[model samples]
Target chain A: MPFPQFLFPNSKFPSQVRNIFLFIRRYFNLLLFLFLQGFSIYLIVHNSRYHNAIFGSITNQLTGKVNEQFSRVEYYFQLKKTNDSLVKANAKLYNKLKADFELPDTTSNIFVDSLKVDSIETYRKYNYYPAKVVYNSVAAQNNYLVLSRGTAQQVRSGMGVIDPNGSVVGVVTDVSKDFAVVMSLLHKDSHIEGMLLKATRKQAHSAGMAWRPISLTFPGYRKVRKWLWETASYQVATVPAYQKV
Target chain B: MNTLVKNIVRFALFILVQVYVLDKIHLHQMVTPYIYFLFILWMPFRMKRTWQMLVAFALGFTLDSFHHNPGFHAAACVLIAYIRPFLVNLLIPQEGADTNYEEPSFKSMGGFLPYFIFTGVLTLIHHGWLFLLEAWQFGNIWYFIFKTLLSTAVSLVLIVVTELLFARKQSFRTNTA
Candidate 1:
């Protein structure tokens, strides 16, 4: 090794130092690859454990914008299907409207108007806000749905999401400026309690846990199977934090 | 200038198709076609390896953002990008003989058989790493293997079809450039 004597005139390990530099220069690509791989693994471990605070927020905003735009194109293609579902939901709601029914004549009977009519405010416990699903996937173990509504529209984490027909969709997990991430019911960690209306007399209840074969395949738990199978008609509403089922 | 523009367009097209179209098609829970790695695979051989890895990281990170899995794709992509030059050298021993071929394609890799093998091996490695990181356990080893193999098969088919469709056009453009 013809080492430059001027740079390290008195150094005893100058040749070794030069060799180290040569090795680094020779395999710099491999070093870079390992560094990048380690960075990616770090990101995975960090983001998978808890809500990512730094890069997550920035990437979430960008992905939210792009998905929102892409979903518009998809929404256009599915306009007919969306219109049909909306019509069906409309018909169902229209039949339950107060204007569709009239009180029968009760002239022969004594009328009692002791109950206060303006007490509906006490019974109104929940409010529903409409939002579009900008992105959704059922293929992953931990599936998440992104909604177009976010903090801008008063959407907050821990809020429940429901479809047009009032079926449980998901629960809000993260919120950005113009978008929110919902942990869908198909996720492995999503646990929901489903009540069986037909067994109301018996007080039979079932826990609706998603993606668990033990819950679905248990032979003795016919009630659980029935509730899980009747996903269309049966409704799972989010109970208030203060209330217990 | 033309090659740069062409690669940029290819990058956008690959990301869009992979995220929007291929992701929506739920063929099975185990089989996901990840043909987006073809962007890195098709990168020019003359480009620096460090730059290739960086580009692969960006591509994988972009896909990861959309899928909500932050690092799995990025790790797999970087690994493949790092190994791509070695695979090319092993497969095509002669260097200056095919100097005109700017990128690896059917014609550049000598023939369809070599290209197929090259693509299949890389796809297998990429999918294996991704699915392994995704499952992150050996409890279901069979499940992991099946998922990797099935996804590799699907991705290979899509990649070969894409190459067949666009390889000639790419070679023509490279020649003109």
Candidate 2:
């Protein structure tokens, strides 16, 4: 059986050079294939939950930057669609703000007749802080979202983040001066207090929430604050400038 | 000039479509169609395997960066790129192999069947390896297989449709020169 000549069709070069070329030609595919496969396996093996979170954030930042640029370009094409959605969102926001200030039409009729007054104090529990999502990853075992608003914008680590349609997104986990990390509900370790609307019962996406008391009674709460201020002075000091003033 | 511009546009389009669009489409909460690998699939046949693998790695890494899944895509893509030449040798007819086939499309490959089979098999391999790495520690064997198959099917359909819709018709006889 004749050896294949395609590996070294031209033999004009020196013997050593030709031999090296022949050797590379013979084992190039296997060598490179194994090396890449091994590298990939290494990546897979090292991708623990911790690494996943860290890597996820890094990629999220990079992709977010690219997506932002792409979105800017795409924004021009979908101006009409975007305008419609913005109008709808604005309408919804208007309705919500209106409901907070104005009395019902039925209440006006009652006011015209006899003096019928009610003292129900209807107040908003949560203030919506609109933040741009700089990075969001949904395809990992543990998902996270990075938002532009952080401690500088009065965004705390415990704030509940929501989607445009008012679906629960996640709670803020970590916050820097200018950015915050949200542990999305899609994460493996994410366990939130969710009640099914129709069933009116708690549902666990993961394990049930275990309440670990960082502060229990009033006295303990004071102690916790004192400890936090002492230990986390650097973080506390970086509070929004307005708050300090 | 045309080829360079076309590939450049395709690279951007695939990355955008995959990361922004297809990656988000969790069909029935299982399928994530990766049409970006079509970039690698549609590469010139005469391109070296080494270069192909390198391009494949870049493609996978870029995607991994976006999807937040580390090396899974890269590994699977490299494996497919490695096997691509062998698969081509096995599938490409003797006469067709002698004749230069620039792109792997239905018209260029002489018919739809070979192209479909090639794309489908490779897509299955790529998805299977990727999902395996992703679900490495999971207990459900059936679910892994299900996800791989469903994803492969979806990717295959999307790739074929994209090729049919976008690929230019090439006459192999005229291009023989």
Candidate 3:
């Protein structure tokens, strides 16, 4: 295996030819490294902002497929925890229904729609379109999530995303027609406005990786109680101040 | 397992862990541990350059696809793979030029310090090139140095810890190529 047959065909031809072949084989590593490094540099230098948009989408499409497969396998491992949360949520909903029925009917025994039939219409400021997480990460300095739904289904950048249990997962950062990327709370650049539930003090904290203490950056306060939860794979902590709905 | 099959499996496992696990860990603003490079570092010492470079490219490209930075990781990987043989020669001259050493672990490398230095220096080089290329436009010399050093430290610690916890002792074998 000193030299492949294709490179050293007719080794019997001449001594000089064999010598050249041997030399090439000896230094082949250097040649290959230079060629590869040049190509890599070309890719880095030629990738303009205009091309990044196109490239980014292409990468997302490719990674989305593979990551979706991985997430499926990971989903099995978390089924018990997910199931537990679902059961708890169902019980809460059941209790709420029971409490509502317990209220005495002031008008009649039959249930009646209570809203006045007015000419005016109502609109919702925020619409939650549930999407499954196709991919998620908690280890990177800048973590991102890939959602199964995308712009085709009304998912867009700046839209809020939450887990099944209603935690502040992240906000949609990029959107393709059929896939979307979310900059998760674990990202270093991620900053969400929050206020302590028990106190009136407002502060801003930069998000850290899961299970790590999130750092408080605003108001220059160093003594704030940093919450560290034994976070799960799919659900991390939700900022109480920013918890809407 | 045969060397070929073992390397293939290692390549896949390293890529998977890098993309899904290590990539998610943001220990600090400056440090991002790239443990996947361990795949290249730990490859059988006797493997040919062509195969090593090819495998390195594939590993880096896979990571590049996940990281969404085309060719960055691949370039760094190729660079390190290119220099690996030279580093082996310089560091382990006692093995002689012809010895086909097994996978580089603490036991195989004779002791902890050689293995540590080998893994650490290679990791530093890889991380240095990676961060430099990534922060090419930043033009802040201090920032680049800080990031490279910090990331190298984190990666070194993780690699050392992983080797200690998972590496199994194997009887040393030597063959002449």
Candidate 4:
């Protein structure tokens, strides 16, 4: 039976059942393609709510995995600076303790200087858990930093990341079994609460919104601070100065 | 049937790859690659021109949903698909291209000349239009050119490599007079 029979009335096969059936089948395939493609475009133009939900959670999980793998690589590279920041941070807390008259000075009993840490707390008991950067995306428009710590490690979302110098880095976004994603200071998406050291006030984004943070991204703000501090050393990201975990 | 199934698989795979892998390759807050349009390039040669443009748009929208610049890739893809049939006809001679003509294939499309010329031109147009849509400002005009070339080069490499290794065993489907 020759295909494409019913469409044209000028058929010569005497309209056999087999030929008519074949014609239907051929047209059906083409029709199905048209219907499906039209439906696809309809779904697109209408911005159907169904497809949107499917992607958000799927990519979130994938982004989490990708961020994890990347942070592991970056964590390895930043190990040395992480260690030095830890030691220096430790010594800083120690001097503050002695100045509070809680420790008997051995060398000179000159542990008496009015520092902000002392003002914030007579004994500032801040604990940092040292976790590697499991995923670090310095290039994403909405970059995130994932750590090797999670809820199991007592790390919660919104916990501020501090550098060795006790500066702010980012906040915990997602928490897994033993992994957490940090929305880094460099993340164009994140604008966490931060303050200037010298003025001790928050330097808002050029838009002048402190709480409702916009993209006043501090790409080189920390470096500028490091230079201002008379330290031509290096700059750090989300985990601020010497506060290591 | 096997080739049809293979093409289906390739289409799905290409979309997944563009969304999962390529869109993540942003640099300096720019550099969006328009490689997803390669799906349009691999369509059956004799497919209707209008359908080709329509499918190109679907492919583009799928990727755009996963990207920052929504509708940018979709619009560019439509332009490419619109120009594709004319471009393909221009590059390949219509006479000897017989039944079961493999689309843009090295064997059926008369070796690499027509295939590369057609695909390369369409891809550049797609990428160029896409970049312009995303970045219309003149402040970073130099960067835009670099981005367009970079994206076009990457997409072209992907297209050529895909055609060489993964192109389906298309039969002579072109209905010639």
Candidate 5:
């Protein structure tokens, strides 16, 4: 009688449900598109891809900014403790920095002094940049974190971001001149190599929502992936050689 | 602003809001807002089918750009856009009635139920895909199912509340207040 009925000749729903089904049938491609999109979102959420993660750089910038703003109020309360830590750190590193790198005569110093370790790039092994979180969206299937630092700040895509708590946040995905976005560990499109802090020191690609505490998944549970799932504080590390290019 | 400027601003604003405001929420350990899909839901009526699909793809892509996950959101949004025409035609009963009308507003569609159904089904479809893709090999099917249902519920509720609060300009006899 109508376009929908013309499209749905085989569905078995009551008249009311059939009407809806018929309509959906008429637009089957959209449904397929939607389904595939959902599936793709799930893939992004669970799979791993450094060059194409959905929530990498922007998410980092965003969360970094929010945390910074929040820290303002937080700093007010934790000022004493923060200052105390700063003084202790300053006192400890001030002499060490001068002695380590600023040494008048270069001795056989195998290790660089930890005092000059403030910037990530200062170390040859890792590149680092200071950034502010400008935007962060973790509530979606593909959550993103944005940062205020970009090419100007030498913040490249694929660098790992972490909270002070040692928990893995995500990696840098994109960077503009003054802004960068990161994918958070809690994002549906998130995955990272994480090692359990236990004696076994198990490692797996941590994937799951930042929402669900028990959401993280480890692959190859065929033998002992299940056993290694118990508990661990995770960290995000940069994949070198790839991001620099 | 003209319609073009208005729509552009709307798109950018939503993206900004989604990333800056909604993404910061950490409820129980998992993120909650996931409202980037709202862009697809809130689009104006009368847009072309092909354009709508393109917009859906673009919406997902933009969101994907915000994160590092590509193709996933783009795919989901495009699907929803493709299906939108079918949903509207079924709900509106276009039997030589106002075919050229510019929107799927409540007045043209007869009521909120049709609109709700249209939006709700698409929402479910989108969330379901998102959850399953994230699941990959699967640990607990129930958890994924629960996430789909719960997230759908929240998104639908928000849509309903927003419609009610806005008192949109179109008030047809068939539409709900």
Candidate 6:
């Protein structure tokens, strides 16, 4: 006539049923805690494929939107820095322009202008696309940078990223609808090929002509150019003025 | 109702700070402070155990979404949530006398020492679990331990400073109760 007996009329384990009910009631919180923990572990173990396909996209979209909004506020604070970098980049580009270099001392050397302007189009090798960095980090072991450009802007994985001053930043690893994640050069796994210019005695002595190539692997090479330039300048300064023919 | 509103606002603020601000600060490779776990540490003591775990899970999941790691934060959050009651009960002997204390804080947990120990232990445990899971290997046990300790120290300092700066006074708690 008891509830457990009535529910299990054909069974002889009514006491076991009652005990099970008591156990569930006594440890309901533990049961719920275990369930939540188990679910989270399941998510972690299956995160690469199953979770990414279903929940990852949705959360990515939400987080991307929120990060984009937050980055707008951050962008204001970084306006001066960004502008400074841009101006420096502009000056560097202007210095490289053909107009910047006049007929270099025509009296000392004969110069011939035989190249056609229309033929310059065939020499283009690389295309540049500018994207705003919505999020970036340099402190983590595996650093990543998020850009505002994505598939909609033709940003895809395997594309190399560069800063305004033509320095290598990273490579795009993942792209969503409106955002892309770049694996920064600072990342542990990022290896880039770079040429080390060794200024030999002969080259260093010659003013404005010190470029000798030595191949090297550049991992986090942001300061290599500056450091090498400084050393080369020091070498040049130490050389006697009589060496400058 | 007021407490509920306050908690909701706290949730939003914690998430924003964790994702937008703390996550951006590149202090060091080994000293990434994760004070968001403080949300679980500061939840109302009288809250139902189930609700506490649920809220912790939600907080962790939201952080994981931003971090691009599906369940690391969620697992750590739930573990801390489950152990919090036991930790509080173990530390605070006179819980019945201080029923007016809405949540764990510098003022509620008696004084500075007990509060620091309480939050410090929780932060250590949370960081250990989270970092271990992130490493997912015993190959570099020393590196993992160093990272856990460094991060725990930073997070504990941030937690204590936040409590000192923004934690409501005990007088406010008495009035609310």
TM-score of every candidate relative to the true structure = 0.82, 0.63, 0.61, 0.52, 0.60, 0.71
Candidate 5 per-residue lDDT, tens place, B127-154, comes to: 7765665565334577777777877887
Cα deviation of A210, candidate 1, in Å = 3.3
Tell me the TM-score of chain B in each candidate: 0.91, 0.90, 0.91, 0.83, 0.81, 0.92
RMSD per candidate (Å) reads 6.1, 13.2, 9.2, 10.2, 10.6, 10.1
Q: Which ten contiguous residues of candidate 5 chain A have the minimum total lDDT?
A: A227-236
Off by over 4 Å in 2: A1-25, A51-60, A69-130, A134-142, A149-182, A189-245, B95-99, B171-177
What would the per-residue lDDT of candidate 4 be over residues A1-245, giving only the tens digit for each residue? 14544665555446576676666666754454455445434444343112233443344344455556655665677789888888998897887675567555543422233454454334333467777664455443334555667677887666777556655556665555566666655543354433333343465322111211112254665554444233212322223322334
* Rank ordering of all candidates by DockQ, starting from the highest: 1, 6, 2, 3, 5, 4
**Alpha-carbon runs more than 4 Å astray in model 3:** A1-26, A48-62, A72-130, A136-144, A150-245, B93-100, B174-177
User: A129-241 in candidate 1: lDDT tens per residue?
Assistant: 88888999987756788889888888878888878777777678777898888877766566666665566568766555554322323455576435554663466443334
Point out where model 4 deviates above 4 Å: A1-194, A198-245, B1-4, B15-35, B46-58, B61-70, B95-99, B136-139, B165-168, B173-177
**DockQ scores of the candidates:** 0.52, 0.33, 0.31, 0.13, 0.22, 0.44
lDDT of 5: 0.58
Full-model lDDT for every candidate = 0.76, 0.66, 0.69, 0.57, 0.58, 0.71
Per-residue lDDT of model 6, residues A46-117, tens digit only:
753223656755776788898899899999999999999999889977776766668653322212223646
Instruction: Tell me how far the alpha carbon of residue B27 in candidate 6 is from the true structure, in angstroms, after superposition.
Output: 3.6
CAPRI quality level assigned to candidate 3 from its DockQ score = acceptable
Q: Could you tell me the lDDT of residue A67 within candidate 5?
A: 50
Superior by DockQ: candidate 1 or candidate 4? 1
lDDT of 6 by residue, B53-157 (tens): 999999999988776657888998999999999888877747463476778877777778888888888898899888777666223566678889999988878
Residues A85-189, candidate 5: write the lDDT tens digits.
658656755655645665453322423336675633234444444455545554454566666677777777777775443345677766655666676665544
Q: Which has the greatest TM-score?
A: 1
Q: What does the lDDT read for residue B42 in candidate 5?
A: 57
True contacts kept of 4: 0.03
lDDT of 2 by residue, A1-245 (tens): 13366655665678888888777768887888899999878876776343355555556556656766655665587789768867877887777564676566343332142323543434333456788776676655557776776677887666777665555566676665566667766665454453323233455222233111211333555654454333232221111111110
Q: Candidate 3: lDDT over CA atoms?
A: 0.69
Name the better of 5 and 6 by DockQ: 6
